[model samples]
Target: MLSADRMRAHLDNARRHLDTARSHTGRVATATGTAAATTGLFTTAVMGESLLATLAATGLGLLVLPTHKARQPEPEKVIERTADGGMLVYTPPAPPSHQGRTAAVLYATPGVGLVGVLIAEWIVPGFHWGEALAVALWSAGTWLLRPARRARHMLVPPLPPVEKVHDLVVQDEPQLYAHPAAQWWAERVAIEGGAAPATVLEDVEKTGESAMRAIIRASIPGEPVPDISVRRLSALMDVPQDLITVGPVPGRGASVQLLTVGQADAAALDPARLWAERIAPLAMPGATITAINLGSMNLSKEDA
Candidate 1:
């Protein structure tokens, strides 16, 4: 039996899948129309060719066109709670690369036949029934040869033994934040930064106060307190005015970290608020937001 939360999550995932399918259907419809138009033009240009011959040529083209093999159905993987109170998800390894080689060889037969026919017409003195039969046999033989060629190349090549290392190198790097919360925050900030500075500046001046006030007023269910900064907190909570600081809490960790502090009007804040509302549900659960600091740190290194 599935938990209520798990069932709801599954339904949400289904809805997302349906939306994606609708989007794809629209694209497929456009592609089909374009392909029909192109084919009609091609038919007009080749008006003298017999319909049967044209179809044969098209069939041969389809067979010869280089395409990756039909993808194998992935094994169904189930996620379940383990005895250790952790989630366990089964992930299957990828299918072997050469699994479809035989199928590819079989499909190449018509292309080989078309080539053989062309060759016979050029080489033979006259187009005759015997010549046609010879071409057909040659084509079949060519198609059968492909699988043998693939098999011959299947042996794994031996690797060279490694020699002693000449140099040792070590570099210290900051550990990157991999959590979805960090990624979402970074992406949101990047998008906001990409907007016209003049427009953002205007917004910073106009709606900054109202947005900040709104953030403080909005109720978030899980947070310990309304702890937030003017910049990030405002953005997260959809507050307009740029947040400068907050009332100090007893423990330093209890207070929200201030990410930014700057002048922002209520107007500029509206867009950020709208963006926050759009992405809030998708953010990592239990993640806290800080204000955006627009100090020297926010400036590009090149500009600095």
Candidate 2:
């Protein structure tokens, strides 16, 4: 859905709005027809395939349209044009922090009042606002005991559209994109903003088949260090035990490198050909994450 042109976004929105309007008009027409019949204002003899009846039929036709052809609910989101002339459509933001006065006020406003009235009528000696105030204070104090917000941003950009690479894409560089796993791995790796990274769990071991692995830290900062041991091997499903023997490289950002073993050696990089420049760039419309490893992954002649 990524598009450099904001006009295209507007066009897409327009198309969506048009479909919604049509759906609404169809519903209105059906309702109007029903009302007219119920009130006895309209009768069959007077409406027999004449111009008025023809118009009514056309209006009713929209309702009878196949369910599969129905219009989807229009999006409430507005795709605003960004400072960079690019547009940004907001995804769902992380939940609000519940540790502050906000949470206290929320509890005090409802739960405290209700609980206080019940207590006053049954257990407490008094039925007064003062007692309610005291209960609200107690609720607020207990809420403070809960965990605090970590200031995390959960609504990262959506994943790039999974696309079909041309036939020649795999053929031209079998060393990089040959095996079915090559493109699969590339798509995972190309996910911008670090969704694919995890800690290396074990030392690299290989047979003729594959290797085992794990992770240290994941993409989000302050996220718990993942259990990368063999006990939690399923966390890194894409890392086949046969092809890539991933291990910790101390002092690296991710501290992990996927090394090619006998079977994984089939994915060895050949720099003579460049797919990044030669291939289409990944498209992520209105995404906050910058595209990486998208255009080119080969050595230029200058480097050679």
What Cα-based lDDT does every candidate model obtain?
0.41, 0.38
Q: Per-candidate TM vs. native?
A: 0.19, 0.18
Report the lDDT tens digits of candidate 2 across residue range 60-148: 43233333322334445657898899988875543344433343343233223333333343444434555445545544543443111
TM-score leader? 1
Off by over 4 Å in 2: 1-4, 41-304
Q: How close is candidate 1 to the true structure, as a TM-score?
A: 0.19
Whole-model lDDT, candidate 2?
0.38
Look at candidate 2 and tell me the lDDT of residue 138.
40
Model 1, runs deviating above 4 Å: 1-127, 147-187, 191-237, 240-304
Q: Tens digits of per-residue lDDT for model 1 on 1-304?
A: 9999999878777766654564464344334323332333323332223234534544653454333444455767879999989999997775654545544554444344444444444455444666545544653453445322232223211223334466646576633435543433434532334211111111111234432211111122333333333455455646455344444322223212223344556555554463454234334433345555555647788888
In model 1, what is the error at residue 64, expressed in angstroms? 30
